[model samples]
Target: MIEILDPAQLPRARAVGALVATILQTAKARCQVGTNLLDIDAWTRSMIEDAGAESCYVDYAPSFGRGPFGHYICTSVNDAVLHGLPHDYAVVDGDLVTLDLAVSLDGVVADSAVSFVVGQGRPEDTAMITATREALAAGIAAARPGARVGDLSHAIGTVLRAAGYPVNTEFGGHGVGSTMHQDPHVPNDGRPGRGFKLRPGLLLALEPWVMADTATLVTDADGWTLRSATGARTAHSEHTVAITRDGAEVLTLPPAA
Candidate 1:
């Protein structure tokens, strides 16, 4: 179900968004070459409790995934892109890591993800990460009120395809507010002027991801994990936005950082 928050609920939405953003940013800053995946999960747990928020992932069980995600954050490295379930592993220099986070505060939810190299990384990996960010921005730009879902998808797809990257849209963005994933699935590529029309008070999360070589995907042995189809590097970037009467407002930007 798609939710359109009234002014009263928008504040809670903003609070949830800020919490998600700050936690992810703080965790991203602490990740290093020697960081342990479990440690990262612990840190995320601490932050979520400190804020009196609930993790959208900890007990998450979707038909597509193994029951109970059991992790506070998604730690995707190199070949792992989406649905990355953290495991017992130590990050190595130049390892590409993507942190996907979602939290609910005061009955509202916000979700976002960021991809970055652990340390000094290969140029190709660096470029791929940047491309995902660029595509994310384009998608948000197309999320204004009166715009169609396909418009946003098309905007993101244009950027990724132009950069010579493959978009595996099996998993993309979706309606977000009282819950994590809602109706109106936002694909990474589509024809413009199609699909759900954007309306005021609607909240949507737009994410754009790309694999270096192929547009297919493979789930890992863990069942909750998703990796690049061709074992190629992948990157993802996302943001939670609210559709305003005039346009779109990104509710997840942390304080200037």
Candidate 2:
């Protein structure tokens, strides 16, 4: 179901967004060449508790996932891309890690993700990161009020395709608000003017994820995890946003130090 937040509800959404941004930034910064995946998850738990916010993933059990997420955050390293459950492993130098997070503040939800290389990494990894960011920005630019969801998807595809990367449609953005995942599943590629229409008060998470060379995706041994079809590198970036009369507002910006 799609949810449109009244203007009054936007303040809460912004607060929730801030929390997500803060948590993600904090987690990403602490993640290093030798950081442990379990430690990252624990740190996420601490930050959420400190903020008095609830984890959108802790008990989340979508049809695609195994029962309850049972983790504080998603720590996807190297080949692992989406729904990467935090595990008992330490990140080594050159590992490309993606931290995806979603949380709720006063019942409002905010979701975001960031992909970065650990310990200086490889040239290819750096390039993949830049491409994903460009794709994400393109998608957001096409997300103003009155633009079709397909317009956003197509914009994302155009950027990725031009960058010489393949798009993944199995997963993309989705309606977000009081709930982590909601209506109008935004695919990475589609015909412009197709799918749902955009309007003020609508909240959506526009995520663009791509692997270095393949369009296909493979599920990892863990039922919830998704990886690139090719054994190549990957990157993903996302943000939670609120649709406004003028345009969409990106709610999850890191707090000013």
TM-score of each: 0.98, 0.97
Clashing pairs in 2: none
Report the C-alpha lDDT of model 2 over 62-100, residue by residue, as the tens digit: 888885989989888888889998998999988899999
Candidate 2 lDDT trough over 10 residues, lowest sum: 220-229
Work out candidate 2's RMSD over C-alphas.
1.0
- 65 Cα displacement, candidate 1 (Å): 0.6
Model 2 alpha-carbon miss at residue 200, Å? 0.8
lDDT of 1 by residue, 100-169 (tens): 9999999898999999998898999988988888988899888888899999999999999999997777
